[model samples]
Target chain A: MQRRIVLDLDLCCGCRSCEAACKAAFKGEARIRHGDIAGAAYLPLACKHCKQPLCLASCPVEAITKDEKTGLVIRSAMVCIGCKSCAFACPFGVIDAPLVRHISQKCSLCADREGGPRCVAACSSGALQWLSDDEIKRHEIGMRMVSKDLFFRRKA
Target chain B: MKNINPKAITIKKALCPFCSYGCEFGVIYDDFGIKGVEYAKDGSSGGRLCPRGSAAAMYLNHPRRLAVPMKDGKPVAWAKMKKDLTKVFGSPKSTAVTFDRNVTPEEYAAIIGFCEKVGIENIASTYFEPESHLEPFLDESFDVSNLQKTQLVVILGDPFNQTPMVSQAIIDWKLKDRKNGLIVIDSLHTHTAGFADQFLRVNVGTEPLLLFALAQKNFEGIDATKVTGIDRAIIKDVSRRIKDSKNSIVFACLSFGHTYDPALCAEGISELEGYGRMKIVPLVEFAGYEGNKGFGSIMEMAKKKKIKYLVNFGELFPFYYPQVAPDLKNLEMYATSTLKHSGYTMVPVPLTLEKEGTVYTSFGKKKLLGGIEPPSGARSIEEIIGPLSGGSGKGKQLSVPDHKLDIKERARRISEATLVKGKGLRLMGEKIAFNFLGFFEEASLKMNPADAMELNIASNDIVKVTSKQGVEHMTVRLTEDVSQGVVTVPAETPGARKLFEYDIDTDLRSVNFIPTEVKICREE
Candidate 1:
């Protein structure tokens, strides 16, 4: 089963514990970013690992690849040239070219480790969850059902 | 830096000293210092921690940590430093010691004993505020676990920002039982307010007035809409909810840096308890172990008598209230035992993870801290103060006096006092948890979206906030969370302290007041 990280914005407190933990785990590079949005809401942004990965298509040296097993968009530093094409092309803005490293870095979802991303583990609130595509679909359906029930109950 | 052997990993149990909630976490370490902190399923926290507790390991071995004692900006021998301290505080009666509340009970006892032996009556903790006169009504023994059983939970102030664990517990309760009522009463629309079943955005200092209105059950006379910025319908609904609930818990967030009459709030809770079983849990943000061990008494003595010399254990004074620095400087000599250089006769102390002793939690429970020895040349408070006092006696327990409030008289006083009104904006201050080298750097002013628009100010724009006392410049963060007339700044920021007006509450015998008025403008 393919795994993905899901962030429920409603439960996120914007404490940035995930960012701190990710940075610590990834040698000072935070794979996730958290910031406030309009209407006093906070959001955490990370790589979506899309089916049509823009970063993979935009890389000049074909440095970015998609993992078929995990469905994670993996960026390889070994094959990448010091070019900014992929960083610019990614819609999520999760990729960055560090001045010190000269290579682009992004969230790898902690695929090499046991368990999932450190960001998920570090989340104090149960806002960040690791789930398969089927689980995500079920979660969405469950949330929709709850909202519908509440709406009908209020109307009644 | 030394290479850590992953094979030699050891888990050491300790309490997080960042805040007073005193959540215990297991420190993962190898041959090197603290590698990481793992949540320990114990204590009031129930195996949960905020970002501060999780990131404590990074702070423990921070590059700028002081490892040795210094004199006049130069490293000094421990023996020489002791000699200098003896000279400065030759007559113990003329000397006073002020410290942070993170002190272990043993250290606090030793310090008190030492002060007593030296004929010194002046001892104070940074956390020492005059115990609220409203202490009698506050239920000190209210268990945190009882939140789960409560049908209604009323949270005053943002515990989600101040004490995350407590807020998490409330959230958990609400999530588990959809029928449970969670009411958040705050001046601003705090993050926790989003989760509330009912959010009452009360005016800044009118918290006491609203509470008073609730306590007296006289909703008729008071214009609830004008006074509290809450509609009368909502007020009646909340009152009915409180009246009907079998078990209700009110969690009051103390130490929010903004003052509201806690006594009046307590009185309201007491009134609600009359209708049914109600528990009032005061959530103080800082650990007051020093305050628990006779620090309040020492403060009382200091006010009555003149203290010639003041020696501070840790960087407590500046962190507590920078205004106290002038009074400390007035003393014949001032010294500090701190983790960083404070340009005084400095004695280095170990970080919480590097020392071993018991620390008091905000809940008044004692927990063990530190399993490893302090860095060489550094010492714990007990080690220094213990030897100085000749180890004669243990410290006295905290004596919280029970003062009965005349609710009628307090209501009269509340009505008589001028409410915050004018062209200026309301100033609110909050204590942000994230810090580096024990100093808060993320100081910014939060403005309401409407206010920001009226002033032609945008997010990240530097703005000038002018209170009666002084003016400060801070970056603007516009959000709809705050009301139209208020601006909130982090209380620990450099210039935020000067904005507050200090009034000695004769009844409470404490010098604390929330400054409510300020004029905001965009900086060109």
Candidate 2:
């Protein structure tokens, strides 16, 4: 089953636990990036795992690819040529360019762990959730801002 | 065949010692060594770990983990160190014994036993962080279930960043009811303050004044509104609501250099707690223990050159607080530490994480399993103080000096102190678990956009901050969270910590690292 990690901006308190988990697992390079909306709301961004991956297309050595079985974006360290192309081509700006050993850092959704991404698992608040496409539809992620009180999520 | 793999992996459980939450997780080890930490779903806090808890594996397997004694950046033999210490102990009258964090309750008792045998009368605690003043508030056991049932919650500082494990509980409770009231009082706009129904932004180092005002305690000459920048009616109104609320809690988490007087801040909490008839829960990295004599006595002796040798237990003391280094002239130091430092006689010792003992937490005392051994050559307190062999005594509840608080004098001083002079900025300190004692990343300075614009500094630009006591260089981050004429930094490292000024309050006879006045300019 295909899955994705989604962050609820309303619940995030800008504590940066997701990024710390990534940095702890990997040496110091955080694959999951942290961004804030003008110091108001914390936004934890991850790989979209797009159908047509831009990082795979930009890779000169064909190191970046998608696994057909799991529909997961994979970055192979052995085949990677340490080129900067993949870091630049990512539209979401999730890929970190200046990584240790000059290799492009990408999230594999914690391929070895059975649960899910370490970022989602280590989230201090229940802001980050691993959901299937069907489960994602159920949340209707931005329902509060669209239908309910726009200010409610901003406060409370 | 699955269980017959040559490199078998073993998982051992341990508690995080970074904060008072005392979270449990699993440490994975193979034939080579530690791999990483595993989230324990059945453990407390529902397997949720903060940045500090997640950094446990790295902290254990860090390259700088000291395995042997070091002197002047070089390894020293244990026998040589013992001989030097023994000779220094010849004059026990001039030798002082102190302890700080990273010490278990058992280790503290052992230290006291060692002091008695060695005739070292100058006993004091060197862990002088402002959070130490909040130790009394942790007496009441706070249940996580209480967050959901309480109608009103008052927070003193930013617990979201300091103790992230508790964020979900508070957040879940606030979302459950629209009528729930959350009040935050802080000097700067913090993440927790953003979610508050009322954010009372007080003047720097004047938190005690506002808190006292909330309790309806007044100083005859001091105007609280003029000093704290908070409206008097709002303070009264919030106090009334808290007094009338059927169920409420006052959660306090203090930061270093954030207040002018820490003990006084605790007094304010006491007053508010009495007025509201509510329970208090203080969240801190460590619930510190005090010594027979205050640390001020040691400083006074050092200034007069009456002390010759100073022996400190645990990691933080003199290394973390270099501002007090000048007073100890010609005083040779012997300190037990987990990491190596530039100067001082560094004895390799086991951190509390690697030792089996009980530590005080927000809820209660919890035992450490000591599943992992200390690095090679690192000795326990039992071995270091072996000559004075005695059974470790019970963990004594040491109390801070609770003398009569002179409200008028303190209030007047704080009111006048917060009046920032023109072209000067007040430097405040805050605690961040992600910074992790500056072991992972360098400390950054947060400045108001207006101040940054005036200094011609931008984000990511280096700035030099100079105070009367010391100077520091840090990367600048401009934000409106901080008001104008104020700059804040996570004073986690030695360099950042050295910049702040300290005070030895004559009333309580305790040391307090208060916010300092500084001039900031873009570094060329």
Candidate 3:
């Protein structure tokens, strides 16, 4: 019933346009971080906004919370300390550790904009997609990578 | 400028001047100023923008934007600067005019017309990116959708990082069928290479040899297997597949210091283009306006004291080419810039985004709407040339020098360069959309894990990279993306770009280099 950002690994080319869009919109604080699969694959890691969020539980000051209706995990800059507990507690490691204004970087999913998220809009490869639960279930998310055709993979 | 609500947000549609894709995006502006970039859904790529396009507004509203004329690193009155420039142009015979990037085709034509009207003879292009070597392929613009029908695609450099807009189509085309062959040839294990049907990991600076071999063009003393570290049988089979394939395209995204013989590399692409009956699609960033001669000839004239006053009408010139600055010490430079740079008499000029003109792109020419006004104290090229005496005439088109190449000689030199054991890692330049102008991301060095361990370097270790031109500190990223003896740094940042050493090839009459020898040490 909720909309979330999903990544199609098969389409990503690791350009980092999504991060730039986020940083540009948020005044230089990148909520999304990047990871390399041993230089074999590049992934842009954004907040999964899980059903049972751990960042919301790890926040000592209770700065992180999830909206029950939209399922958006939001972080308040005013209520937060610079302790980085939420960043450490994040299982996905999507929360960036380096503090720009002494606050853990968290993705708000471009809540201010009407078009869902800016990362999906500026995705050059169309890899990052913000979709509703129904659309997410209909599309084959991560099954189309090299597993179907390992002939292209020189070394797994 | 329009009758709209003061508080309402508006987006001005403009073509991205960063690269040739020319994807249309919007600059979000309200009553205050430029807010950010908006991805236009109906635009070329259907709202998909690269990092460079996304950061356009950030660059436009950067704190370091030059808003006034500067001389000797000090702000000077525009009147005084204009008078001084007019006096400098009094002796147009000794003056030379050059350009690089950020100039529209109309602006380039205006510059050339002004040069002809003012009696300035020495006009040349100073843009020497390896992508410029792919100029011949730009006669016809190919759409990205063509890749879907392509039976094979042989990519030269990392298109994923250099030009990310094409990556989606490439991936879809590769996955739509099982037989769609994708051959990536590079020294590094790039993201595109990971998706490659066969990645020919070549020796450093030996890509040209592999290309030539694939084209079936053999030269004396050139054993592609020995020189490029790629097996000959594999090369032969891949070459056969490409030739046998019905539709094939060779996508070139060359970077600075990535090739030793750029002209020869272009020739190799040409050979492949003809042999395989395929088209050559160069992912050009910006094909700069050319002059009657190459920048090498202009530099020669400057060194000989023939050119005293150098006036550039582009964003990058003497500033980006730090290595060529010392040679032109005898000459005076007055360059136009949108961002604050340290050298020369910088004339604050409006970026192409604010100008109403046409720009040459991969998909032919596109027009800049010029809805945005020029920054205060900044002027356009046409406005700047108003005071100077000249009746505008259409300037000459790209009269590029004919580079005659001897395949055997180039192969020999490249083979020798690859065979020579260097003391340090071979520093190759890379381009990433996010690292454009170093505004979005910091420069990081990509090296192989084996090479990193040998130098006692770890991932994220701050390492001091020393090249012949300069030294700079970069965070090291240990990955198999780079070859063992090769390391790549994005050339978008001046700190990393200046660390590259450039050489002017005599035969090509163009500047090119294979890779710089950079010694890296972990900063304790």
User: Highest TM-score, which number?
Assistant: 3
In lDDT terms, how accurate is model 3?
A: 0.84
By descending DockQ, how would the candidates be arranged? 3, 2, 1
Better of 1 and 2 by TM-score: 2
Q: Write the per-residue lDDT of candidate 2 for residues B1-524, one digit (tens) a residue.
A: 34565468888888887777888888888877898888887778777899888888887888888899988889989898878777776788999888888888888887776667667778888988888878877774578788876899999999998888888888778766767888999998888887787889898888898889998898888888989999878988998998888768888888888889887788888998988887788888887778877888888888888998898998887789888888775688999998777788899998777899798778899989678877988988878776534444333545555578786788888888876464578899888777877756688999998888877899999989898788888999888888888999886556787889898987877789988889888888
Compared with the true structure, all predictions reach lDDT values of 0.64, 0.83, 0.84
lDDT of 2: 0.83
DockQ of each: 0.29, 0.56, 0.67
lDDT of 1 at B286: 49
lDDT of 3 by residue, A1-156 (tens): 688899988788788989989988888888888886654567899999988999999999989999999989999989989798988899989998675588888999889888879999999888999888899989897676645664237342
- Please provide, for model 1 over B1-524, each residue's C-alpha lDDT reduced to its tens digit, 9 standing for 90 to 100: 76666678787887777766777777777776667665565644544666677667765665655677786678888888777777755777777676664466666677766766776655555553322433443344566778777779887777776666565466557666668788888777776677676777787756666654544365434554576767777777777787788778777764434654555666665666675456777666544433322333444445555656667765555544555444445454344443554456667777655666665455665546657555677777766665666654776744434456666665544444425356777787664443322232457888887888888999999888787667878899877777777788766454666676555443544445464678877889
Q: What is the interface RMSD of candidate 3, in Å?
A: 2.3
DockQ, 0 to 1 scale, candidate 2: 0.56
Candidate 1 chain B worst ten-residue window by lDDT: B432-441
For every model in order, what is the iRMS? 6.2, 2.9, 2.3
In model 2, where do residues sit more than 4 Å from their true spots?
A: A140-156, B1-7, B389-397, B420-422
Per-residue lDDT of model 1, residues A1-156, tens digit only: 988899865466555667766665566666787765545466678889999999899988888999887788888879988597888998878787777777887889987545577677666666778898889988753253264232121110
